[model samples]
Target: MKFDSVIMGGGLAGLVAGISLQQAGKSTAIVSMGQNSLHFFSGSFESMTEPPQRVADLFKDAGIGLHYRQGVRLMPLGTFRESAMSLEDIELFPSEKFARRVLIVNFQGYHDFFSSFLAEGLEKKGMRCRIRLINIPDIDPTHQGPGEMRSVQIARTMDRIWEKVVQEIRLLLKDEDAVILPQVFGLQDISVPGRIRQALPAKVVFVGTMPPSVPGVRTQMLLKKRYQLLGGTYLMGDEAIKAHVHEGVVHSVVTRNLDSHYLEASNFILATGGLFSKGLVSNPFQLYEPVFGLDVEFAEDRNTWYNPAFKEDQPYMGYGVKADDTLHAIIDGKPLENLYAIGSILGATHPELGSGAGLAINSALVAVDQILSEK
Candidate 1:
């Protein structure tokens, strides 16, 4: 198959690049290995610097509904850290000051949330809070431990237990300025928080649960839908295995699922993500880009890769493929004119705070710009 551009990896970077390219009237295809980072998203688009306006607009226009609040966002532990933007219903404050009195709703036996731990952070902020627990049997039908119930699991049965939860919280509501709930609303339901807020006088906010969170998956799937709507071909559940690189450019790539049929494109993007995600892999004392084997940038001595202190930022976080001024992936110390690398796999991000979602988004936009500008 042929396309204007073939992007490897279907994470946030690949999706954004694909959507932007399609919007520019360029045929784009994304070969995704598996789930993207959004599966573990922390409910915030964080950045050390202000996020580009296009980043906010991308979410707003894609129907995810963005709020350009460049202030603190609710961390999993309930502490607030500055972020460029957050989901419409997240437990975020415009500044460090939060509501003095708040109600925290915890689903009975939900393990991902720790009321005491969360309360600690809130207490540090000088807030008065109450813990309210509600039981929902649908979440654990087999009578197994509810501790295993992740956010996505809660979301699957959320529709069945939605009203019950709403009413239960209603009874617990008192003189609380805000209600903090686990982000277990519908998979695509961004209105649950708002609806609950309407029922109670208190503002409703959501804190993300474990992996495959309702909000994370919701955002991931929704953005994917937007890509499909824009006519971008998504090769989901497939991975690129071999790149047909000729001279300085990549002409085609073969995937594990489509080994025989070569997927060709005029340009290619490698966005498979960093070492943890396996976009960039390490062997012995060296690191390698899994696909296309583009040149990578990292510390020469592996000892410097990590900090002895686990709490400190690790050097490996900033290591990734070598790219030039235009974000073109460097192969054999030379820029590959048709191959651009973006996002986590492009690394060296070294974000000051949060998960670097803004950095990833900005890189994707920059990559798309470079691709369309090509002859």
Candidate 2:
């Protein structure tokens, strides 16, 4: 199939670019290898260093509504806590009122989250918190190991028995002002929280945990739905195996799944992510971009890739494909006119410091603007 633009990744960057381009009346397609990092989303965009003032507008342009609050908010997981520059909209009890008393709920067999830890952290933050446990009869008898039970699995199970869980929550929330839940609200139903809110007096907030992220999954589904609604083609569960290039411009990308298929486009955006997504790889010698063979900037000595302190950012975290001022990939100081690199695949950004999403969104805006300008 052919389009005006083919986005090579289905993560935040690719989805943003696809939505922007498609909104600009360009025919676009997103070829992805199933779901991306959203499954681990923490219900917040951690753009501490460079908060995007246009975040609300970007989502609004895509027809995805979200609430944003400036300044850092403490995100608690178990007993640990971290900070995010901004938080997306969440349903809170007292229905828009500050939660003076918060009830944290956990499932007995769900190992993905612990209420006690969150309660402790929230208490430390000077919030009044209490812990409540709900035992779902169907889940207890399954005999699944902790590792075998993922957030998605529990979410699906909870969704199937939602009425029963809701009744139980109604009983537990009698005295609570708000309830904090693990991210197992629902997969595609963005209105789940709102529905729950209507049924109860307390506010419901879904916070994500380790892997198989609930909030991240929600954002992914929301963006993909908006993209498709805008007439953008979405090919899920496919991996780009080869790039057909000529004179430094990527003409098309070949994807492999059940069979090989070629996707031709007038322009390409490589949002294929960094080390985690294997967009960039390292051999015994040096780091290199795997798909299009774009040049990567890295320290020559492998010993310099890591620091002695584990908590500190590693050198390899900043290694990615080099991009020019227009956000296109640069090979040996020459720009690949039709090929742009966005998101975690570009070099010198520290995602560990909470600026990853902002960088991705801002760069995507720049890339799409450049594409429209050239057209």
Candidate 3:
């Protein structure tokens, strides 16, 4: 198969890149190895603690509509910590107005979320909050423990009995200003929250937790749908295993599935993500970019890779392929003529901030702009 542009990795960056190029009348293809970290998405996009003015414009041009908010919001997870959440599918009440009565809804047998913990944190923050645990027998028939059940399972089961759940919530939320729920809405049900809000008297907000992220999956699906609508080809459940390079230029890439197939492209964008996604690998002493053997920037001594304090920022988080201002991957101190890198793959930021999605989206836009300008 051949395309004008081929994107590696189907994460936020790769999908955005595909959409941008396809909308520009370029024939694009996205080679993905199944789902990316959107399964663990934190329900928001973070560009920085304070994103720039251009970030909004960039998102608009990329056809990604996100609810832009400033500053950080406390994610309702273990210990209730502060994280950046720029975009939200549901309506998020401002922190100041959140002093009203709040009801946190949790599903029975779904151990990924702890409503009590979030309620306590909100109470400590001076918000009048309480917990309401709804026992949805259909969601977990066997009463599986936390380790046994996945977030996706609960979300799917919830979809099967959504009307009942909504009716129960309507009764439980009397006089409450807002309803906070675990990210357990259906996988593709982006309209469910809005529908619930319209049916209920209070506002609705979905908080993110660990893996099998509902919001993350929604975002990924939204991006993929938009990309396909713009005539981008998506090769799902396939991986780009090798690149046919000639004199530092990647002429084509080989993907693996049932059979080995090649995709030829004039331009390539690598957004396979960092060590977590296996885009960059590391040993005791050296870091390696597995696919193309691209140059990686890391501390020589492994001891400097991590801080003595576990909670402190680690050096390894900032390690990734170095890129030029045009978003081209830099190898041997020179930029690859036809290859560009974006998202977590080209890094100098802390992963703890959960800002990779925003960075990925913005970098994808920049990379596409450069690609089109050069054409």
Candidate 4:
């Protein structure tokens, strides 16, 4: 199969680039290995720095809705984390929409959420809130025999007990300002929060739990739907295993599922995530870009790769495939004329800086711009 552009990885970066390219009248295809990184998303876009109007507009064009907010995430462990944007269902910190006294709810056996933890954070942020634990004695919410409860599992079955939860909330809520719930809404239902909120008298807030996040999955589905609506081809359950590069251009990519069937394209994009997602691989000696063998920048000394402190600046987070000003992927110290690297795969994109979503979107757009310009 042939396309105008082929994007490897269907995460936020790859999808954004594919959507932009398709919108620009390019026949684009995204080869992905099952689900994307949004499965780990917190339902909030973390950014230390916000993007410009143009950059923000790209998401609008793609139909992924975001509520830009100047707020922070109230962590359960007692901390205020700054946030830039969030899904409409999520509640940012210090929201005036809620009253002074709030009631936070969690499940009895569900360990993923702790009302006290978040209440502590809220208190530190100068917000008064109460904790309520709703018991689920009839059913086992645990994933694997008395272990921690999974948000994804709970989210799937939440609708069954929706009315029960609402009733409990009403009983527990006594003139409280708002109601905070663990993000166990249905996996694909963004309207669940709205439904609960409408059913209740006060405001309803959804705090992100561990992945696979319902909101994150919903975001992924929304973007994927928009991409399909725009005629972008998405090849799920398949990944680009081999890039047929020659003469400084990527001729095609061959996926493991399609050994001989080449996905030929005029231009290519590499948005596969960094080491965590195996976009860049490493051995004992050195690090290398998995696809196309492009030049990557990372620490040579394994000892200095990480710092002892978890919150401290880890040097390895700054490593990725090296790209030029035009976002073209570099191989053997020369730029690949037709291949560009974007998102977390691009070097100098530090997640700790807290601008990952913005950087990914911006880089995707920039790479799409490069492809458009070169055309």
Per-residue CA lDDT of model 1 for 45-100, tens digit only, reads: 76624456666666766788666657777777867777756677765577755787
Alpha carbon lDDT of each predicted model: 0.79, 0.74, 0.76, 0.78
Model 2 stretches with alpha carbons more than 4 Å out: 48-63, 71-102, 126-129, 138-148, 160-163, 173-178, 198-203, 257-261, 349-354
Q: Residue 233: error of model 1 in Å? A: 1.4
Which residue pairs collide in model 1, if any?
none
Residue 126 local lDDT, model 4 = 68
In terms of lDDT, the poorest run of 10 residues in model 4 is 347-356
Please identify which of the two predictions, 1 or 2, would achieve the higher TM-score against the true structure: 1
> Candidate 1: worst 10 consecutive residues by lDDT?
348-357
In candidate 4, list every pair of residues with a backbone clash.
48-354, 76-117
For every model shown, the clashing-pair count is: 0, 4, 1, 2
Model 3: per-residue Cα lDDT over 99-196, one tens digit each: 47898888767777778777877777677887888877676647655565677777766666678888888878767887888877757565565666
**TM-score of candidate 4 to 2 decimals:** 0.89
Q: Model 4 over residues 43-138: C-alpha lDDT tens digits? A: 667562455676567667654566776776655464656676777676776553235777988887887776777787677656788888887643
Report the number of the highest-TM-score candidate.
Answer: 1
Kindly report the root-mean-square deviation of model 1 from the true structure over all alpha carbons.
2.4
Better of 1 and 4 by lDDT: 1
TM-score of each: 0.93, 0.84, 0.87, 0.89
